[model samples]
Target: MTDRAALQHRLEQGIATLGLQLPAGAVPRLLDYLDLLVRWNAAYNLTAVRDPAEMVTRHLLDSLAILPYVTGSTLADLGTGPGLPGIVLAIAAPGRAITLVDSNGKKVRFLREAIRSLKLEGVQAVQSRVEDVQGQFDCITARAFATLADMLGWGGHLLAPGGCWLAMKGRRPDDELEALPPGFALASMHSLAVPGLEGERHLAVIRHAGAAAAPAAC
Candidate 1:
């Protein structure tokens, strides 16, 4: 069994080191998610990383690293596999309603269970092609979904007016930015310093120049 107290302390330390201050109640929720992820991974193969310590450092903490820059009321996660940043964002920002979108049925299944088992409110999992979904959101996020161009092509429509896309990329997305179709401008880029992780990570915040529409068109 996982040591709950140890997990809580680790999460606390991770956030603190990253210069993030989360609410006191977020710890239990984080612990609950870590537990569920471990249990479900055994059956669903949701993730390859099975060690709880590594998961805290890699998945949960890494996801939370982008939380400080996410600006939105309701967020949409494109190609969410087992709800990385989406579920973590929902838990971190309790008031933000998050919709987790994925094309894989198995991943969506795991996402549904994660949402249910964690009793995560304001979180809905949708199994659909990212470009086919129709809904305007305050923010759109994708982690390791695809190349920046493809991700933006599919998920760009989901952004609401005056909203932005928080695409987490490893290195600077210069080539991907060049491939962007139109009406999008680079807003800001945040170099992520994930606690206990090596190498460089970044969160590219891109904004639309014109009005935003639903994700029905690529």
Candidate 2:
């Protein structure tokens, strides 16, 4: 059995280490989400990180590491397998409207249950290819989803004018940056420090070429 209290302590410590001041009850809600993910992951193999304690740092903190860069009232997470940053973001920022998009049916089902179980008000799950998702969002996130070129190529239309795309990557994607399609430019790149996690974690902040640039440092 997973030790819920221990997991919650680890998550809380990580949140403080990141210097994030979430709203009341956000911590417990995040822990609840973690528990749900762990339970669902057991049978469905939703994520590679099976240990709930490891999920605190690998999943929760890794996702929350990008919270500062996420802007706008509406956000969409593309290729959101098992609702990594999508659900985590929703729990942290209750005011923002978040949509989780994925093509995998099993993952979508888990996302739906997560939303229901968490009682997240402004969150929704959509099972559709990233290219086919409708409507525009002020912010879009893609976590190791695809090559930057192809990710922007397929989901470019979904980012509203003046919006930004937060691409979660393992390292600075120099080659992919060179291949960004027309009308898009690299705004900034942030080296994320996710507590208890090793290896490189980078957040590539991209925006329309014509749009005002995001703050240079994030």
Candidate 3:
């Protein structure tokens, strides 16, 4: 088998073994994405992991672990570095509209190429900081992006009245939770069991109450 085929096999086995439910059709697209990531990293340095096997285990499965907790018709990825759960979620949830935002122009350009190469629909990558972007979204996500407090402060205005913030973190951020403003409430905190990832992974689902309750303060 070729490298991609082996990677696919590992991904399939890993998902099945981990008992994670993934869109059946997304596997191929993910393989294509991994291939592109590896190629682009040579010039753009999109990710540190170069091995396809490691990408399948670390990046792909780790991203998919959040699949169960996300709820929204549309989603935006804040600080979408190389499209980590954003692109993965877009593939896993094809029906949802996904917009990936990033400050790095090179990364944004890579995201656009990945979208096109993967044949992903309803996905767009924009090169802009979260503060500069306009319009609210049904859901927003950040994976290893910022502190809960900072993400809340920056992403607060972007959430639709009843939208959610899906923040992926390594350890439980108790302090960040305590520091959160009043308007947003903790919807749920799902501990993720990612295949091949040995450390802690938690997906925090936060709901926006209103600006009155939790004023967007710097």
Best by lDDT: 2
lDDT of each: 0.84, 0.91, 0.84
| 71-141: candidate 3 lDDT, tens digit per residue | 76888999989999899888877888899999999999999999888888899998998888888888888
Candidate 1, lDDT over the whole model: 0.84
Tens digits of per-residue lDDT for model 1, 1-218: 35877777788899889887777678788888889889888987989999888889989998999887777678999988889889998888888889999999998988888888878889999999998999898888889679877887877888888787888988877788788768787777778889888888988888886544423211
lDDT score for candidate 2 against the true structure: 0.91
TM-score of each: 0.91, 0.96, 0.91
Tell me the tens digit of each residue's lDDT in model 2 across 19-63: 999989998999888878888898999999888889999889999
Q: Model 1 clash pairs?
A: none
Ranked by TM-score, top first: 2, 1, 3
Question: In model 1, where do residues sit more than 4 Å from their true spots?
Answer: 210-218
Local error of candidate 3 at 90, Å?
Answer: 1.2
Q: After superposition, how far is residue 174 of candidate 3 from its true place, in Å?
A: 0.7
- Worst 10-residue lDDT window for candidate 3 reads 209-218
Q: Compared to the true structure, candidate 2 yields what TM-score?
A: 0.96
RMSD to native for every prediction?
Answer: 4.2, 1.7, 4.3
